[model samples]
Target: MTSQQHQRAAGKRAFITGAAGGLGSATARMLARQGAKVFLTDIDGDAVATVAADINRQAGEKVAWSAPQDVRDEANWERLLAEAALAMGGLSVLVNNAGIGSLGAIGAIELNEWRRVMGVNVESVMLGCKHAMAYLRDAQPASIVNISSLAAFKVDPDYTAYNTSKAAVAALTKSVAVECARQKIDVRCNSIHPAFIRTGIVKPFFDKLGEEEATRKLVRGIPMHRMGDPDDVAYAVLYLASDESRYVTAAELVIDGGARAV
Candidate 1:
């Protein structure tokens, strides 16, 4: 295809929440390399800018923009979209990857922590979908990849809040998929449920357990004896983000290394 044709079909503008950390940063980099103009946002201003800068340095113009955006606040989503329109032309893909990971058994869980996790993980995804649907619908062949957890389907009493929030996300994905189809919106949404990826958030937890013990403990019930990598999830994001999965929607792409299988 010619330059103009490529530009028109690229429609690769993306807004990735939680871009300052973990899987978000990994997916942002992967998307940028694949010709996307990425607008990255995080709650941490410095981290957000740092990741955007790193991507720009590595990929040049492909790295479009960056800012601090709190996913918990719907206002932030609106502002980010405005900025993304100017910086990257328009939004086509949204990676709702921002979430908190905290452990709390249901009975002893604090109300505030439970609300916070649900607000960030579940509400944030809903907000993104709510605000971006119009643009996404118009864009056609758009994608929204939400980051859920294996715990969404498989219960873990220790992390009740996180698990419940992800389960909501999974349910929301299905709801949105059906709505899009009913309305003929041309938008696609899916959830990615990952098991124990080696992101920084889990690093200290694993460190405390020691490598061998951590590995064994993580896979204690899982069939896979290894922890997942951010890239492992990133690749899954790319598959859904691209036209390769054009007909795929309302699906759960579990990147647990078959942990959830057994």
Candidate 2:
């Protein structure tokens, strides 16, 4: 018997978006290690393939898979999700983690940029929820983990588009959760709101200014004076994706480094 046979997920099959790197990659690795089959997708085909290969190599088994995806496309969502479910047996968990930031404030932002941000951050979640509902319904007591942000509740003047998109994700999670409950589908939906994590979109800052300056600039606003690790949010995602959170639906789990408290 292998370690995968120990089975914490109890035959959980997860489909994760934006899994080429950062939180998505971390969550995928954690889930695979904890005995779940993970289907990873990202727009960057090469990167996601590498991620899947590394996971399989480390596990000594084919526990992870990957594909290229543009989350904004409805047609591709239908096709890829079905493929993922077939590949992994069934789709019990869906993580809507693909998102991007806005360039400027409300007054300065271009409409095209706003639309682009909304398409990736907000519309993509809606598509995932709608398309994955049937598969999750079949795999009773399943979960949909949407990656929102603290910006949804915390006001940031320069990031109006990003904030609004995250807020929509939070609201969308609640709507899907209630609908599933009412329909007696046994599928739970929730959102995770993280603040200034080391990975995600903030890694670019580290590349530009180097670690020290980047860390200092980002942590100055947080009460904890530190950024969160990818694993911090990954652990939250693992909890939400498993049966341990059976009774938890439409909940917003904040993995902020005390930033919201201040």
- Clash totals for all models, in order? 0, 0
Q: Which predicted model would earn the best lDDT?
A: 2
Candidate 1, 110: how far from true, in Å? Answer: 0.9
Among all windows of 10 consecutive residues in model 2, the one with the lowest summed lDDT is: 1-10
TM-scores for candidates 1 onward, in order? 0.94, 0.96
lDDT of 1 at 227: 83
Q: What digit string (tens of lDDT, one per residue) describes model 2 on residues 1-262? A: 1375565665799999999999999999888888889999999999999999999998888888999999999999999999999899989999999999875888998898889999999999999999999999899989999999999999788998899999999999999999999988899999999999877588688899998999999888788889998999998989999899999999999988888888
Q: After superposition, how far is residue 85 of candidate 2 from its true place, in Å?
A: 1.0
Full-model lDDT, candidate 1: 0.85
What lDDT does the true structure give each of the candidates?
0.85, 0.92
Candidate 1 residue pairs in clash (backbone atoms < 3 Å): none
